[model samples]
Target: VFTLRLIHIFAIHKQLGPKIIIVERMMKDVFFFLFFLSVWLVAYGVTTQALLHPHDGRLEWIFRRVLYRPYLQIFGQIPLDEIDEARVNCSLHPLLLDSSASCPNLYANW
Candidate 1:
């Protein structure tokens, strides 16, 4: 998004000098659309991966190593009740806190 925005702003700034207002508005809308689309794609990808490989160990390995593990490290595994909610927002508190090091607690509910 940043790269594309930079290109649009710099590469075509002069070309759209007369109608830069309209271009900027359109670019903002496009940026927001792509951001939401990417988010939806990621959600769909993860859901599809889980559904397609329900019993596959590779899926677990990939999810843990690629996503959950780092998440645990950043959040610090601790029980939900034991979590310091004051330090984190309610939405993020659960992700940031889990009792198990591998984040089974986190994935269990997800």
Candidate 2:
């Protein structure tokens, strides 16, 4: 955070009488800004359910969620028939799948 780092440096300067802190506040600000920017970018990028493909069967994204217990968690009701139909028509093959391929069979009707 440029704002936070600037304040930190400004405060540290007063405490130490204008000496460079152990870490450069500029670098700290850059790293903080980049970290939050990365998360913000990812959060913006991953909101679409169509982009995130979660396998109810093979890859088991639900279990992965339980294991990871991180943010970005989402839940929704999925019909059993839909999952079955998707398993029946998954011609794309499991090889081409990642976390961003749309929930399996979520759009089988399309």
Candidate 3:
């Protein structure tokens, strides 16, 4: 859907011809169906794995010992590098000082 939307935008800008735009729009439905099918397969696989593995405690141990600390640390963190800050905040209006309040950094901005 995003790819088709982007192609439509390019078509609007006259970078892509009408024939390609039509083909892309037609393929969007096929893409949507495939996406949902893939998601369903992933969910089915995970459920099957859980049912097959019973309660061995390994997953719980990994979550508690390996993932919990990093998850908490990542919850509310900011990058300290100047280049990173600039790259992130370039889309933001100059008056907005908070990094969290920055505008979306899109291809058009870059």
Total clashing pairs for each candidate: 2, 2, 0
Native-to-model Cα distance after best TM-score fit, residue 22 in candidate 3, in Å:
2.7
- Name the lDDT of candidate 3: 0.47
Candidate 1: minimum summed lDDT over ten consecutive residues — where?
Answer: 99-108
Q: Arrange candidates by TM-score, descending.
A: 1, 3, 2
Which residues of candidate 1, in runs, are more than 4 Å off?
A: 1-16, 57-110
lDDT of 3 by residue, 11-84 (tens): 77654678676877889988998888656655544443344323323455334323343333345432233224
Q: Tell me the deviation in Å of residue 51 in model 1.
A: 0.4
Please report how far candidate 3 places residue 95 from its true position, in Å.
Answer: 57
Task: State the C-alpha lDDT per candidate.
Answer: 0.49, 0.47, 0.47
Predicted model with the maximum lDDT: 1
Look at candidate 1 and tell me the lDDT of residue 81.
42
Best by TM-score: 1
- TM-scores, one per candidate: 0.37, 0.28, 0.32
Per-residue lDDT, model 1, residue 8, is: 61
Clash pairs, model 1 backbone: 77-98, 78-98
